[model samples]
Target: MSPSWEDESAAVIAQGLRRRGFLTAAGLAATAALVAGRPERAHAAVSGSRAMPYPFTLGIASGDPLSTAVVLWTRLAPSPFEVDGGMATDSFPVQWVVAEDASMATVVRRGTALAHAEYAHSVHVDVGGLRPDREYWYQFRCGPHLSGVGRTRTAPAPGAHLDHLDLVVASCQSLGAGWYHAWKDAASEPADLVYFAGDYIYEYATDATSVRWPYTPSLPADFTRQTDTLGRFRQQYGLYKSDPDLQEAHRVSPWMVTWDDHEVFNDYDAEDPSLYQLRANAYRAFWEHMPLRSPQRPSGYTARMYRQLDYGDLARFHVIDARQYKTGQLPGSTVGDTAERRDPSRQILGTAQEAWLLDSLGSGATTWDVMANTVLFSRLDSDDTAGERFSTGQWDAYQAAQQRVIDTVAAKDAGGFVVLTGDIHRNYHLNVLKDFEDPDSAVVGVEFAGTSISSGRDGGETDSGLEVRTRANPHLVSADLRRGYLRCRISHDVWTTQVRAIDRISTLDYRAWTSHTLVTEPRRPGLQVS
Candidate 1:
C-alpha cells in the first residue's frame, strides 16, 4: 500500500516513541517488516560482469543525504539518446557501486536498478547506514556500458561540533540563455556542498528567437518546443544532464535540490490531479537524472523530495517543495495589504508540506536552519509608488503559512534562522519579517536570495521600479539584477554569505566578485548582524 503523509509521520513518531519504550521493540519490528526493503527482483543477484567496462558513458550525479546515508546517481548510455534521450523504447538494467576511493578497489555498496522506459532508464540508489561527513566515490554500470565516476559526501551528524561548513546555493538555470559559468564557478568554489535550490531546466523549449533576443521561448508558443508527455520530460532531463559542466559539478561533490516554477510549469496546483501528473512526471525525471534516493518514487502525481539533512551541529538543511503542493495564484498575483498576503486560506505550501516543515523545525537540533526552498520568501515589490501588489505565487502571498513557519521556529529554535531563497532571477538580501508590511512585528529570519544562472538578463541600469520597491519595504536592505550564486560559510557563532556576481553574462570570460555580504549572529533575529 502507498504511504500517506499522516501515516509516514505517525511512523516517524512511532519510531521515536519506540526508542523511549512507549512502544515495544517487537511492535516496532513488526511495523518495519510491513514497510521495509526494495522489491524482490531488484535484490536478485547479478552473477556475471565482475569486470564491468566503460563506466560513465552518460554522466555522474548525486543528492539526498542524511547523517549516515546519501543517494548516488548515474545513467548508462550505450548512446545518450538510447538511455536518457527518451527517444528509445527499451529498458536496461543499470548497476551502481559506491566505494571509499576514487578507484573502485575499495567497494562498499553495489546494486542494480532498472532504467525503466518512462524515466529514461536512470539510476537513483539511496545508500544508507554509512558514516557522516566522509567522502565516497561512485559509478554506474549497464550490460556492457559504464558511467563516469561521481563523488558524494554524507552530512555531518546531528549535534556533533565542528569548526566550519561551506555551502554554495543557486537556482533558476534556463538552458537557452547562457553557459553554466555560474555552475563552473560554483563547482570550483571550496564548498562542502552545493545546494541547487531549483529550476535546473526550464519546462519550455526555446527557438531561434529566444536563442536570439527575448529570444528564447523554450520554443515558440505556436511551435511548442517541450513536450508535456512523460517521454518529453525525460528528454528534457537528458538535454540538461548532457551538459559537461553541470555533470562536472555533480562529479565534484554532493548536491541538495528542490524545484521551483520552471521545473514543472510557471504556476502549478496540487489540488488538480491531471495537471499534477505533469509535475509528477517532471519530478520523476528529475529524480532519475539526479542522485536522490530510490524510494523517492512518485506516487499518483507527487514526489516526496522535501526532507532535512543536518551538518553536524553547525546547520540543518531543510529542503522544501514549494511548487507541487501549492494553490497557484494568478501568475503575477502580488496584491496590496497583508490581509490578502496573509490569508491562512492562501497556501504556498499545501497543508501537508506545512506540517512537515513545522514538525521538522520543532524536532530538529541544528545550530543553523538553512531552507533550500524555491521562490522569494521575503516581501519584494517591483514597484513602490506604482503600488503594484506582490505575486500570489511567492511565499509572501501565503502570509499566514510563512508566519506559522517563522513563529514555529522562533518559539522552538531561539538560535535564529537562515533561509536561502531563489527563483526571482535577481539577487537580493532581505531582513526577514514575520509580518513584512508591519515593521513593529517580529523579525524572524534572515534571507539570502541569489540571482539566476542566466535567467533574467535586464542587464541595463537599475530598474526604476525597484527603487520604488526599496522605498516601500524597509526589510529589503539590498537587491541586484545579475546572474550568479551565493557562497555561504558558517562557523560556530557567525554566518557569512557572499553574493558573487557574474561580471558579464552568457560569455565564458564573465568575471565574478563578492557583490555583497551579510552576517548573522546567534540568537539575533534578522540580517542586521555585522
Candidate 2:
C-alpha cells in the first residue's frame, strides 16, 4: 500500500515536472485527479455514473505533440472483451471536441474529461490553446455516442522554420499476421506524423497458422498465447483495437509511439524482479492504450517513456526507450553478435536514457535529428565477414551502447542524424557506421528499417536472403521483404525515404507500391537512389 507513486522525490519528480506544462490542459486535469482518486490503491475501478453504455469502442487517438499541446484519446470500451472493459464501476462524462474545421465548423476547444473506471475507461485529453502549426479536428462524446473524427497536428512553432516534415514510419503488426493494408495506406497519406516503431501488440497468440478474422473468433477456453495477467493485457488491447485498419490508422495520423518486444515478455527486462508484476501489467496496459501524456502515465513499474518532440526549426525527436532499461539478451545468441556482445558495461539507452540521448544530440537546434528508434540501429551483419553474427535484439546488442551513439554523432558535428527504425521484419537501407567493424567506417548517420505492419506472414518482393544480405553487408542500401510503411520527406536539403509496399496482406484489396526510393543529403552521410 505504499505505492501511489511512492513519495515523489526524483528531485520532487523533476521539480514537479518543471512546473507542469507538458501535455498542458492543466497537466491533463492533474493526471485525471491522480488516477481518479486512487480508490485506495490497485488502480482501475471507479464509480459514480448516471447510466451510460455505447462507450465509443476503442477508436479515436492523438498523442504527445506539443507546440501548444495535443493528447486526446478514448476507451470506454463498450464490451471490449468484457472483464472490466464492459465498464461498470462507473464515472463517465467524457465530452471532448477540438475543431479548426473538418466540418466541425470551427469551434476551437471543448472539454469535460473523466471517463474513469479508474483508468480502463480511459480518456487522456491534454488539449490546449493550440494553433502552432495547426490542423485540428477531434471528437468524443459519451451519451449520444459520437466517437470518430480524429486527425491532429501541432508542433512547428517552437523555433519556427521552413518547409516539410511528412512522417509515417510504422512497425510490426502480427494480429495473426496479416490484413491492415499497411494501415490502410498509412491512413490515406498527407501525413504529418506517425512514428510508432514497436510491435504494438503481440504477446503471442493465434498460432496454428491462423491468418485473420479476429484470429477466427471463438475464444475464452481460457485463451492464452502467453499474455500473463491484467486480464490478459486488457484482452490483448481489446483485440488490437478491433482493427478497422488499426482503427483507421488511429483515425488518421498524429501518433509518436514507442515500445518493443511485444510490449512486454518477448524480451522482458526492467531488471526483472520476477517480472515485476509482469511489468506492472505491461505498463498498465500501455498507459491504457496510448495517446500518451501526463509524462507518459504508468507509475507502477515506472513508465516515463523517453520524451522529446520538436519540429520548429525542422525536426528534433529523440523518442528512444529501448525496452525499458535493457540488459538481458546475450545468452544463446538469438541475435547477439558476440565479443561478449560488445560490453561497455552492457546497457542500451539506460543510464538515464543515455543522458537524455546525449543531451538531445548535442542540442544543435534542429535541422533534422530524428531518432524514434525501437530496435535495429544500423549494422545487421550476419556474415559481413567480421562484426560476427549481429542482432542480439538490436544496436547489435549494445556495442558500447552503439558506440555512445556513434561518438555523439561524431562529436556533435551532428549534421541531421536520422534513425527511425522498427524491429526486424523487413525493409532496410542502412549506412549508419562510425565503426561497424570499420569497412572504411565513418558514415555516421542514416537508418530507415521500417517494414512490418502485419508482421511476417505474406511477404516476398525479393528475398532469398536478399543477395546474401546485401552481399555481406555493404551498409545495405535497399532490402525489402514486403508488407510495408516508411515514408518520410523532410526538407531543408533532403531526406526522402519511401519504401511503401503491399502486394498482399491476404486480401482487403489494398495493393500499394513504390518498392524503393531512398536519398539522404543534409550533410550527406550515405544512402541514395531516388
Best by lDDT: 2
* Cα lDDT computed for each candidate against the true fold: 0.67, 0.74
Each prediction's TM-score against the native? Answer: 0.82, 0.35
Best by TM-score: 1
lDDT of 2 by residue, 1-530 (tens): 32211121112233322111112233233323322321211111112242554456567789877888989998887656555766788688877878786546566798788877767888898988898988897877665445556788888778898498888899988777777788768887748889898888888765457466333444444345678787788878876775655776776778989888787878776687888888888888888888998878878877878988888887888998898887877765445455677878889777888888987884847778888897888777665454456767777777888888888888888687888888888888788878777768779788888888887667876755677678788888788788888888898788898899998886555679887788887687788877
What TM-score would you give candidate 2 relative to the actual structure?
A: 0.35
lDDT of 1 at 291: 73
